[model samples]
Target chain A: MSIGIDELEDLAVGAAFLGTGGGGDPYIGRLIATKAIQDCGEPTVLDLDQVKDDDFVVTVAGYGAPTVQIEKLIGEGELEKALAKLEQHLKKKVTAIIPAEIGGSNSLVPIALASRCKLPVINADGMGRAFPELPMNVFSFNGISASPMIVTDEHCNTAIVETASDRTAEKITRAIAIELGLRVFIGCYPMTGRMVRECAIEGTLSQAIAIGRSIRQRPPGSCAIESLMHCLSTIYPDRESRVLFTGKIVDVQRDTADGFSKGSFRIEAFGSGQSAELIFQNEFLRVCVEDKLVAVVPDLICVVDEETASPITTGALRYGQRVKVIGIEAPPQLCSEQALTYVGPECFGMDFPYKSIATLEAEAADKAPKSATAV
Target chain B: MSIGIDELEDLAVGAAFLGTGGGGDPYIGRLIATKAIQDCGEPTVLDLDQVKDDDFVVTVAGYGAPTVQIEKLIGEGELEKALAKLEQHLKKKVTAIIPAEIGGSNSLVPIALASRCKLPVINADGMGRAFPELPMNVFSFNGISASPMIVTDEHCNTAIVETASDRTAEKITRAIAIELGLRVFIGCYPMTGRMVRECAIEGTLSQAIAIGRSIRQRPPGSCAIESLMHCLSTIYPDRESRVLFTGKIVDVQRDTADGFSKGSFRIEAFGSGQSAELIFQNEFLRVCVEDKLVAVVPDLICVVDEETASPITTGALRYGQRVKVIGIEAPPQLCSEQALTYVGPECFGMDFPYKSIATLEAEAADKAPKSATAV
Candidate 1:
């Protein structure tokens, strides 16, 4: 299946939801990706099973803090140059572009590069949800090296990181991005088609597009939030979703430091004696109600505008804005004992242990009074 | 002339004197360079006129704070790897190695690599004396791009910086060096034989070796310092050398910041109660006696032990140590108006005006009382 320019908005919206309140605002990405399609024709997106074992897959996305990203959007030829450099280093043609993470701008960057290069995009991604760091992905969890990676600034100043571990690669690339003003494009994690099938979280592109469509459908009398939850369960029966908080943002704090947007925000329930707080580092890492952890990393914590049900990235959150926070369970692979070591609550330095959104919500329901509700 | 295992000491000693008060300690470099010559046999040395117009000349050196470099030495294979990566990027064979700067470690790195790769080392250098930053080189002074350069750590985590201005290349590499523990090897300033012949400071290697020998000769009835100054005049009548002060180090301060050993040290004359202050970032930038400027950057401000007459690097300075501060005029090209724009005192953020070492010494001589001797 290929993504036409018309469906780009739907994809962006869905990607924003899965971005977990990070991945940057997708409006600019949508514009660039749409223009790329018009200039070079819609790109073909391939399913994981469609690629042969010998095919070479490359990952492309922006690497930097989300706050800095929106201020200085990707410039012309940055993507083309990075792709060319990556191919030159690999000494072979890239078969397709895979979104390193299925989140707003990260997803769109690959599609845009794909259209410009006349290449296909893999339907799956390294992480089903967005992560702030490079190694916080399934590819790293699967022991893939992130080297031989090509990074490019808007002015075409490029560097090729070769033969570094994923951890050192992250530090090197992050320091570079910070030195280059906190935003640069990277084409990393060169993998085989077989590795893609074995390590990637499948159907993320399609799933993101469908999630975008469900929120926009807005059936009469059916709350968009309720419909979005229904859509999640409909797509993945094993996964669960819940409305963690419905409130107005009271205090939102952010500081761009060490190549990340770090801070937390407080939310007060509308016309109710309940409140919640969400902590984030580029992506929302944890959501807590009355100091009790409700949803943590490796799970989605999507913040949406209350009336329009439009996804709001972490950078777009504002004080006094009415919003709904949704917690969706991650795929089983991301929550496994092995995977948790890389993306779990502890990996993010949270004091508490990792708990499934479903389990946390069930525990809350059991503790609450029969007729009363608590945030 | 090819440098054999025997002349390595003379070369290091001379390079250290030319390095001013920085360029790191040469003890370790001497040890490693001696082993390289023994392992690979003697390497050929090429004069400026030796290389053809089409020959490719690559510059190699270590880049970081001098204080950090000595603590964690360069491991085996680091040089070989950087050279291989650089050559691969050029897609052409490097005909010879050129010292980017003729200073302690910087000068020896080339000889070691030349032996390892069976290549000749150019007898000239980018800077006749070491300057802290990349843009301070004559290659950059001649408008050569510092890109297509390869940098590597001891662990072989390599990155190739290509297509950036020398200034930007410095920032990128510096940030990476800091992130990688403040020391890394770089192969940069890829130039043609024509460029090297036109832009390089010629014969600095042979001069360094001669200076090294003059200091070691220590002729009886005449001070070694006196003999060293005589050697300087004999080699280049166009240049002048003066002992700025003979003192005991009173206060030494240093802070490794922004990938540089930055600080100022004060020295007091042995019995005259006179004092001098030398300010440095990596190499000595300025020397002042009684708060009056005596010498500024783009000139050599070498510090040596009073007893041994051996050059002491900036990192080796200690309180209460008796030393002789010598000021030597830089090569003619380095003092030219065009060259000063890149390495003048103003470039180091000092407010003093540019004056030759001879001019500063003459001014100090005119200011002192007829029978009074001051530091």
Candidate 2:
């Protein structure tokens, strides 16, 4: 399969919806990928089964404050430059590219770079959804080294980090990204095709495109919520998807600290006089209704425009915006005991235990007819 | 010549004196070098004239807050680990190691690593005396690239920085050092023996040892200052050395900020009613007597114990301690127009123009009979 210029819009929309209000805004990414495809032809999307065991595959993404990406536009050829540097360091040609995360701008980053470099992009990603830190990805969770990672800026300055552990790599890379104007392109997790097949979240790029196409086919204000939820459930049969709340944003408190956008938002039910709160650090980590924990990571909590069905990132959220909150169960691999220990709510300093969206919904049903249940 | 365990003490003392209150304390470095030499025979010290043009040489130094060096001691084999990583990156064997700066701990770092790795220590350094920032070194001022620089911490984490400009390399490296507990070991400025001979301050290591021997040979408190000055003048004929003041420290205001010990010290003359002030950032940068500029960077301003002629670093300074202030002319290359722009008073944010110590001394002589002229 090849992703041509015509499909970029759908990819961006799907990626944005999957971003869970993190991964940064995808509009610019869409434009960049579109232009790259137009200039260099469509990028080939290689299925996992097609990858040779010995082929070299690398994940590429932009890391920094999403807010900065809006104003400090990336220069042309930045991604190519970063990928070239990484190839030089490894002294091996890259056979394929993959997104570190299949969310927002990160999803399009690989596609753009692939078109420019004429390398196929693997139809999978390290993270099924957006994550703020480097170690939160599936590859790192599976013990794949993030070392020999290359971080490059628009100015062409490059730094290659080789750390003993993934946590150390994250610390050093994050610090360097912050130092380099809070935005840097990173080429990391250079693994063989066999490792990619074993560690990656399979078919995420195609899943995102399918999800976007499903949402786009529905009328803007007519049963859009139901249609979107139906598409998610059909695409991820094992994962639960449902609307958590429909309300108007009442208040928002956010601040960029420690190289992350950290804060919370409150949403009031349109006519019920009830409110829900969502806490976040780069991505929405937890959602609560009337002080009751309804959802937490690694479950996805996405905020979207109630009327237009367009996903809104945390950086783009504003008070008084009417929105629909939704939660989707994470992939089974991500919720396993070992993976949860690293990406669970506790990792973000939350004291509560992890609970699936399905469990939370069942508990809400048990308290039906009450003034305000969790869901 | 060889530097056995017997010579480590003298090397530390001389290096500390040359540190000008920066480059960290050398006591730990001496111990490390002594142990390494004791374990693996004496390390060879190669003269610049003996180096072949094609020989690969690298400067080794510890960069971070001097205060941290005292409390968070380095683990054994840390320097060797960093050197091994750099060699792996360059894909070639390093023929010899040189000190990045002939100051405090940095001066002995090469000796310690060289002894453990069985490589010769070059009798030269990038900076004749320590300066806080990386670009202040003669290698950078002379247009040598600081690229492919390796930064390693106690945890065995390493990062290799390659940048278009030396300033960018320093900025990124400094930020990483701050992130890694305010100290990191750096192997940078990989150059050929020919480049080292052309840009390095040759024989600095031996000069430091001779200076240490001169001070060590002096009786407890008899004219040690004059003897030390004589040794310095004889070693650096183009440079002038003189006593600027002999006084008790009345006040010392120091704080560690931006990974540097920055502050000022006030010295009141023992018998006269005159006082002088010294401002420093890692190293003593400027001095004024009665509010008149006496000396400024890139000239050397050193503070030492008034009685023992022992160099006292900024981190060890205490109020009410009697000290001797001495000034030595910087090497002519360092004081040239090109170098001064990066290491001069202006670079330190001082508004005054740079004046040679010779010129300042002549002005002070013409103002004799005045109550308080700049020394």
Candidate achieving the largest DockQ: 1
Categorize the docking of model 1: medium
DockQ metric for all predictions: 0.76, 0.72
Write out the backbone clash pairs for model 1: none
* Model 1 chain B worst lDDT run, 10 consecutive residues: B21-30
Regions of model 1 farther than 4 Å from truth: A363-375, B364-375
- For model 1 the local lDDT of residue A114 reads 92
**What level of docking quality does candidate 2 show?**
medium
lDDT by residue for model 1 (A1-375), tens: 779987898899999989987776688789889999999999998998997898899898888998988888888888987888878777889988899998888889899999999999999998898999988888889988888898888878788997568888888888888888988889999989888889899999999999998888867899888778888888878888878899999999999988999999999998876899999999999998888889998888889988777888888889999999998898887988889988999888876778999899889889989777743
Error of 2 at B212 (Å): 0.7
lDDT of 1 at B310: 91
Candidate 2 per-residue C-alpha lDDT over B196-270 given as tens digits, one digit per residue, 9 for 90 to 100: 888888888898898887777865555878778878989988888889888999999998898787999999997
